[model samples]
Target: MESEALGHTVMDQRQGHGSLVAVAEKLTLEEINSTGAISNFGKPNAPSPAAIVACVPKNVHVDEVGETEFRISPSEITAAIKAGLDFGGAYRC
Candidate 1:
């Protein structure tokens, strides 16, 4: 798999250097709701990209992945979903 290959590459580079660690924590439903990105009204509110990003926890430490770690954030996922929706809408147009 691509990820396994990437991990091997990272391990190679960090060999005999020191221990490298990466932590990924799943977001709880409560945490997502606490972001206020969702509304209590019958209709849902569209959250700004910044607001979505704000909801993501930064406690996870990633090693040797460069900036690719940002891809896992809530905001990035939301943006990707929105883009997919937009593409689907365009196809319907």
Candidate 2:
């Protein structure tokens, strides 16, 4: 696939790197309920783009849990450094 498929928007150089990373955790129901888009998924009577779930998670927490966010922790940064990974720059939309 071509990054140009996204049209005139500035593209990331690594778009064509064909990289896939594992999702370490599943979202809690509370987290999923935070947005209609996520909650609509996996429902038989879901709305458009959700009625037929394409990607199903192996697990989901039905009970309440802490909200999750992707934060670059200091330990993670150190681990990345040890792994010889470099930050390209601040993420862009």
Candidate 3:
């Protein structure tokens, strides 16, 4: 549903540039729930660690898993950057 809304916004922007001149003003927390695309489609009540791990590479290296620390493989950083690029919007918030 979040993607659908983004798609609609994109379409609207294409049709009328004036409609979304200030894109930030158009965004709302309601549209970015854990289930929203902004959360990478995660359901509500999910953790940041889990979300971060999801962005890790397929061949991730887990040196240790602790409550406050995570030792992800180098590839994890690459994957996270790729994910950001793939989903980044023109609008800055």
Best by lDDT: 3
Looking at model 2, report the run of 10 residues with the lowest lDDT sum. 84-93
Q: Which of 1 and 2 is ahead in TM-score?
A: 1
lDDT of each residue in 1-93, candidate 3, tens digit only: 876875744455465666656574767766534324443323346355443434433454445842443456668775765576567632243
TM-score of 3: 0.24
Candidate order (lDDT): 3, 1, 2
* Residue 26 C-alpha lDDT in model 2: 51
Q: Please give the range of 10 consecutive residues that has the lowest summed lDDT in model 3.
A: 34-43
- In TM-score terms, which candidate is top? 3
Residues 1-93, candidate 1, lDDT per residue (tens digit)? 876875754455565344433311455556655654343222246433433233455455568654433336566675776676555532221
Model 2 deviation from native, Cα RMSD in Å = 20.1
User: Clashing residue pairs, candidate 2?
Assistant: none
Misplaced by over 4 Å in model 3 are 1-69, 89-93
**How much is 62 displaced in model 1, in angstroms?**
15
Candidate 2 lDDT for residue 83: 54
Better of 1 and 3 by TM-score: 3
